[model samples]
Target: MNDYIIRATAGNGAIRAFAATTKNTVEKARSLHNTSPVATAALGRLLTAAAMMGIMLKGEKDLLTLQIRGDGPLQGMVVSADSNAKVKGYVFNPYVEVPDKYEGKLDVSAAIGHGNLSVIKDIGLKEPYSGQIELISGEIAEDLTYYFAKSEQTPSAIGLGVLIDTDITVMAAGGFIIQLMPDASDEIAEKLEEKINRTPYVTSLLDMGYTPEDILKLILGDFDIEINEKKEVEFYCNCTRERVEKALISLGKEELEKIIEEDKKAQLHCHFCNKEYNFTENDLKEILKNAL
Candidate 1:
């Protein structure tokens, strides 16, 4: 199935949720970055979550960025997404070898160690809104749950998972976010807790060929599942040669002259997509005119 996200409300809007299946998107990321199995899992989970969170914006040009600065072998992970559910990200150390935390599961927490989660939203405001919290667990879900509750003051349940295949490809990857409204009744909240605890892991649901809608129905079935919107999500990076050239122009006349004088050429690597942009001497000189 194509990767997509479902936005919905349940129990008369007292509960809002989002769910998505991101196997293909995660697999794409693994291939582009050539991440190790453990790094793939860690990056996949974060990317999946970021895809859903990106669409939470109400503006056209809004952007959301999630950064994980860890203290383990993995070092860090950075994901940036737009309101269109187009997400791109990378790991600080994508090939760090680490033992699995469980018999058949990747040890994301140990690979990521403990650090901070930073959520930054640029919504055409005076300043981009920013929030940070200590990682409750290096696993993306729990850390996000803690982020929502403490940073946003909204009690939430977040579950994210990435299953790796024997060949080191992504087997499954998906997640769900359920949040309680301010006036959610105690009874309904209790029921939500019960249902969530009984439900299977997000990746398990995806492995069974469950769609985002099906996953939400499994959790929000007891409540009225009012799906709001559905949108395709993908591993997309919007970096272009023109944009990279503009950046080089922004470096000013002296910087461009030095590059033209010393290196005569430059290669720019985009972290989001691992694509390299080459600038020859003539290209740099052309950019230099604009810089001057």
Candidate 2:
């Protein structure tokens, strides 16, 4: 099924919520980076969370970047999302596979280890706003929940999950974020917590062919969840050969000349998408002219 995200409000707007199905989205990252099963889960959860966060933007160009620097084999994970629900991301070590933690499930926590979670929000401002918090459990979901509560001062519950098949392909991937509004009452918060705790994993629901709305219903159950908007989400990178050429130009005339005189050709690879752009000596000369 195609991936999509939904924004909703429950309990008469006392709770703001977002949910998404990201199987295809996450699969794209897996194919691009060739991430191992554990890496896939770690990166997939971040991408899913970033997608939901992206919809919260107030402007078209606003962006949210989620970065996790851990001490595990995965090292780190980076994900970026724009208001349009376009998301892209990669893991520092996509091929690092670790054994399952319990009951033979993907060991996301061990793969992530303990580190810091930093969120940078760029809203076309002079300086972007950033929030940082220590990882609570190295589990992306729990760490994000802690971040929202401590860093953003927003009480939230986050549940992110990615199910990987034996062949390393993603079987399912999705997540949900439920945040308490400023006027949320204690009773409402308790009930919401109870509902969320009892809800099934987001990926499991998606595996059952559940739509974004159905997933919301499953979480909000008896609560009044009003669907606000729905948007399609995908794994997209905004890198281009021209952009790469401009970067090479920024390397200055000396650097360009050195590359042309030595290698005669330079290969630039985009870390985001793993796409390589090759520049011949003539290309370097042209870039040198522009650099001057």
Give the whole-model CA lDDT for all candidates, comma-separated: 0.92, 0.90
Total clashing pairs in model 1 = 0
Candidate No. with top TM-score: 1
Residues forming the 10-long window of minimal summed lDDT in candidate 1: 202-211
Please report, as a residue range, the 10-residue window in candidate 2 with the lowest summed lDDT.
202-211
Angstrom error at residue 205, model 1: 2.5
Candidate 2 lands at a TM-score of 0.97
Candidate 1 residues 173-211, lDDT tens each? 888999999989999999999998899877678678777
Highest lDDT: which candidate?
A: 1
Q: What is residue 291's positional error in candidate 2, in angstroms?
A: 2.4
Task: Kindly provide the TM-score of model 1 when superposed on the true structure, using C-alpha atoms.
Answer: 0.97
